[model samples]
Target chain A: MSHTRYRVMEAGEARRFPPEAMARIEKILTRYPTKQAALLPVLWVAQETWGWISKEAGEEVARVLDLPPSHVDGVLTFYTMYNLRPVGKHLLQVCTSISCHLNGAESLLERCGKRLGIGLEETTADGKFTLVEVECIAGCDRAPSMMVNDQYFEPMDAGKLDALLDRLSREA
Target chain B: MEKVLTARIGKKDSRSIDTYLADGGYTGVKRVLTSGMTPEQVIEEVKKANVRGRGGAGFSAGVKWGFLPKDTKGKPIYLFCNADESEPGTFKDRLLMENDPHQLIEGMILASYAIRCRNAYIYIRGEFYDGARILERAIGEAYAKGYLGEKILGSRFSLDITVHRGAGAYICGEETGLIESIEGKRGQPRIKPPFPAVSGAFAAPTIVNNVETLCCVKHVIDRGAEWFLKIGRNEKNAGPKLFCISGHVNRPGVYEAAMGLPLKDLIFGAEYAQGMKGGKKIKAVIPGGASAPMLTAAEIDDCPLDFDGVAAKGSMLGSAAIVVINEDACIVDVAKNLSKFFSHESCGQCTPCREGTPWLYKVLTRIEAGQGRMEDIDLLARICNQMANGMTICVFADAAIAPPLSSVTKFRAEYEHHVTQKRCLVGARAAELVTV
Candidate 1:
């Protein structure tokens, strides 16, 4: 497996929340009594706005929440969801935990790798899909599950997974 | 016993405010607010019902609420509903949040009133994007209906609930770790003595409860405590419980059964998992989530599926997640998979857990790959002993050790065969089929 570290967005890169994101951020801020308590929600807003959370995005969140840049970086690196580098249009997070593994998640992942001609954590040549093996997404009842973007697809075998990939490719 | 907790799940428009209100929802909170009952009375009622936390700990919910200092003159009390359901085999919380959002909301309001808190937050796991959106919409509907916000239900009580999403960390399921994550830090469990009730969430008196536990609070109020106590086997393990059955089962899904149901029934009963898939003989069972020790097929025959029952059998009813393993799968492989999970998810705040978990994974991987020495077996046990109990700040380290140690003890011959033969015997057949 490739061990690529999270890339840092260079200085002078333009990164600011648009008007709609600002409105959402304001609404989220009202939920918490303190500005710092909204840090995770605000970081989510940043990630939603910029696909992945870059260094510049982290700094912007820090500025908005009045937190230190190092603190933002620490929190960002701790969680697995915040992507620090740009990803494909569709992020396929396959659950490789025990239950999924028992139900053929490894073979399903291998099939994805074979079909896409890319290994786990690699993006497709066309930038349509990025496959990453993740921990349990809590869909054990329907094992060998994966999440494309934010939606869940489960009980997937090689044929069904291939069909899903073909459909996504055509849609994209 | 009736399905009090998950009764509304799978119903049409179950998440909407109108559907919730039409079904006599919000009555629990309304009764609490409108009646002349004090916070202590609410706590006493809950205590009488014996509602235990659905989260792994299974502590008494009412007793935990009573931990708050009576006089927090200037300090604000906070109530956090832990929606961070990331335990490997646990998925019951997501169903309640996604389907019966108002049930949880009503529970939260009653819990807040019992603790006399004005602010509450639901720290949901990051993977549950759909559940979070549904809960957000439900909260909005609640606010619009005046079930929440200022002077709720024309009573002096008021509460504002917020939905905070965690960014993929299993440690956040721990109450203290959850508090730290909501505070915008690494999700690490804090050392106790200041306990959350003493000082939590912005250093205020806080009471953190699981999503299902809070939902049970709604029922404990709607139906009297005596009624709730009469549903399950006994007062100690009262009320309907949600059991998440997965792995090797014919119908692997969430089943709501009375507490203290037999483990064999949950696995083989038609209403539960409908027996193992393909008529395969059961080899072992992980009674709880990956954290609890595995029970050999023989040991699980008549075991009770409750906190005390499972504990009596040398395991926990943690999250009530039962993962059945058939004879086809390798025990060594199961141990290795769980080791990898714990090692990856460890917050690395403690020395034994950070160093011990990865070491356990490395040794297990080596053993699974046919490179293990005989001494590695005793070494593995030694490491587990060191990491278990109160050796660390939290139980994460202890949980990490359960799979490997338990598997080796219960299935020592399997580990020995892998080492001596330099190949996985049980997995060899599957590998051969794959090659063909």
Candidate 2:
């Protein structure tokens, strides 16, 4: 894993959420047929406010949705879209699932690890980047792929990853 | 040295099964057939190997199969391979079918044998015409070789596998919805607890596995269970997993690694991703897929690249395709775009999902277009709340609500700015130009 010591903000550093945020969450709960229906969105709000969904956040969502925290957590854990922790400035989501692997994604990821000076689950010293091995990213024609900051790049190689890192570092 | 599974793609003799056979194809199946591994033994081996589903869910394949009733009660056990790559930012399965269809066939056969399933189907997406065609032809080839029809590989067990093309609906990618579609019904999900394993296709005991999940059977059989278990870095979700990266990276494609590789390593490692586009800094990321929660740039260090890690972070290792966002991007616009997609794709069977989706889109769209009022933002949140938690069946409804709710909460300033200032505070005029 990356550095164990992530910069935790003091409780005072936590930004005060606009009152409307709570009102909005409440309104969303009413729109659902059942309060539990609002669980995902409630959790989403928690994640957005906290930057990641914590156990407390899950409980908050569960309470709003009239469900248990375990229930909310079960749903959160099943899907790929929820984030449980803080992410880096750059998220290196490498696709090694079947299609991408058949196209040489493993070597590409290995190459990325060597060049970037980080392994999966670890962030760069500057906290600028985090490399996560993903399932698939919907781009197979261009194999050996990775996604950086919501943009899709394909047919990646070690060299390409290196250049990208330099560019990200410089930009940061 | 190239791995055996990926050797056929972009190389000489990739499209033909004969070439695949020449290159050690079907050897795993033959081994399974000759080794006298019974269904129980096969299941045991798979469990021992610690293989999980490669599809977005990451469920244990052996455990899922174990859910089936022991011995058929004069009813055929059906197996359906979900080839619907409907999840946004997930396309690895399409390439596997396009390049090497036989590997899938052999793997499917092996899985069927292991589960004692006599009938199976591959429900492919309609958009993947080429993949469907290739896999259909491969099934034919398998039949010609006596590998798919009665008496597969001269074994007593007979199996029939067919490929069914699907109309373009994201919901069909869901397991029950896929089952419904295979049965020629609208692809709407069914309630659980008569899980497909217990009562599936034709109300018979059935097992549904993703294309990649079945394809992995060969790997498990070739290597012993112990060897397979040791492959993944994540002790729990053992063995290698594939990650398809797309987005504003230098090199975005697919890469395979042991489970639990750190997200940091995945990004910087070889063939992971080449930073952001146009030298822009990463602003946020959707680590799993489009449906996954967004990770702000500051929170990237919460967990490793495993199910537990993502779960702890309040997201999942869902079809772990990281959708990265750059500093130039507007979070509001992303919510709008995703909302529009889900709204457009909802089957309209459930009122909450059907109406809530479009309403959410309208609110997000309005907010993104600088046409939102303070109440509109609240409306978006309320609508999100209404549509979540299996409101519409499957996760699509909840998925529809996640982005907008999260966006409004995390980027309230942006939404408030839109309403208060009547313009995007990010100075993002280009973001508003999107139709959604």
Candidate 3:
């Protein structure tokens, strides 16, 4: 039951958003009547920029949206996608819900574990991929779906898995 | 059996506003605004059409819109589109959002006009990254074309649309939970009696409608109510419906057919699923999303695929997410998979849902893994009873109980087999211990 502890980055050491991201953040903020409504999107921008949501990034988001740091952490932890710890370059999320299960999502997951040389929720030694089983990604029509980062790879099998991993390795 | 909502889905540049305009889109809003039709008249048209919410509740959309108070001196009415398509087996809305984003925009604009709201928001699921990008571009197009954001069609009426993305909470699919999420809080449902129409989203008169329901609103205005009424099997269940047939089907995709279409046709018809994969015999069918109870092979024989039709057969067509299980599949494993999903997704706000869901999953997992005694079956039933029928803030608890309760009752023999034999009977060679 031991959990990996993440080093808390202080506010002074937090990476600031680039000029383009800052502008985009402002544009997103204008869409909502209240600055607080932009909390989730702002967190997304931070995660996209920093690879994962660090403690300082959370504080920065809180400061920009004028929310309490504790409030930002609570919201960030409540969601599964916002990774608090740094993950591998590619996050391979496989769907093992009922629809996907009926279509061999279990074996596909096993294949992913075997091929990646990592267990569920475990990252590879080289930090290339992290395999995790997710709930339905709403791709039931194309059962046995998996998401590599933000892109969805559906109706997948052993062959597709090999090709996908190879391509991702090349890109990395 | 004509496709009004998804007709332009697969075409080239289908997501563009220009394509939508060329194919007679935005006419509904134009007709409502320029024709000087009052909001009351628009509501009357929707009421006549009998369009129901497609976000699993199946409540009348017109009746829901009517719940808002007439007095709006200090309060601003808001419309929130429930685009969080996270129901386990549902993916029809993803198609609409990805391919025909403008149809939804038009629908939202028209619905906002009907509700007399200046601002509307599309609360989409975070996992739908591609769909969210598509919707954002579509909203931009809408604003540029003067279809959204102030003085639509050069009239006094003005409306603004915003697309908000949810991080990754399934409970946000619930309307009240969605409101809380948008308000920068945990996605948890609030108590009823002061419904969203009365006080929602920043303490304003808010109205939340499913993406499909609003799209139906657009068609109701464009094609007239009578045409919609004539498309379904009965008056109560009218309009073309999208049946998301997934799982062991040969052709697993979204099939748009008339309401109350026979379940058998959707599963076996060439236009639909075309029959079970590997030519296996149908074992069981989850007629709705994971929330709805499962129907056995014999029981689903003549059942119609509509809210009332499926409800009459002892299951609700919640989201029309049909997951077909073949003979090779084990019911115990299916139950365990769904129970795990509900347990993981439970917001843990209420004691029953937060505690009972994981408990059900634990027990079901034990039974599925062939480590259960006879007393454990009764324990599972008792736990399900504690979670059902208005025991919690939302129906998440009720949904969490559906798989174990219904599957145990109908497929008790399977559960008994897993208990007595200490191993799975069906698909034993293929079955592996699911690690989640």
For every prediction, compared with the true complex, DockQ reads: 0.63, 0.05, 0.61
RMSD of 3: 3.4
Top candidate on lDDT is 1
Writing each residue's lDDT as its tens digit, candidate 3 over B1-436 gives 7777789978889999998899888888888888999988888889899997888989999999999899976889999999999999999999999999998888888888888999899999989899999998999998898898778889988988888899888999999999999988878899996899999998899999999999899999898889888988888998989989898889999999999999999999988889988888777889999999988777778898888999998889999999998877778888989998998898878898888988988998898888998888989999999887988988888888988999888777778889999876564332232211
How do the residues B282-395 of candidate 1 rate in per-residue lDDT, one tens digit apiece? 777998999999988778877989889999899999999999998889888999999999999999889999999989999999999999999888889999999879999999
Question: What's the lDDT for residue B36 in model 1?
Answer: 82
Q: What would the TM-scores of all predictions be?
A: 0.97, 0.70, 0.96
Worst ten in a row by lDDT for model 3 chain B: B427-436
Docking class of 1: medium
lDDT of 2 by residue, B36-71 (tens): 878888888877776777777878888898888976
DockQ of model 1 vs. true complex: 0.63
Query: What RMSD does each model have against the real structure?
Result: 3.3, 20.0, 3.4
Task: For model 1, state the Cα shift of residue A23 in Å.
Answer: 2.2
- By TM-score, is 1 or 3 better? 1
What TM-score, to 2 decimals, does candidate 1 have? 0.97
Model 3 lDDT at residue A117: 88
**Candidate with better lDDT, 1 vs 3:** 1
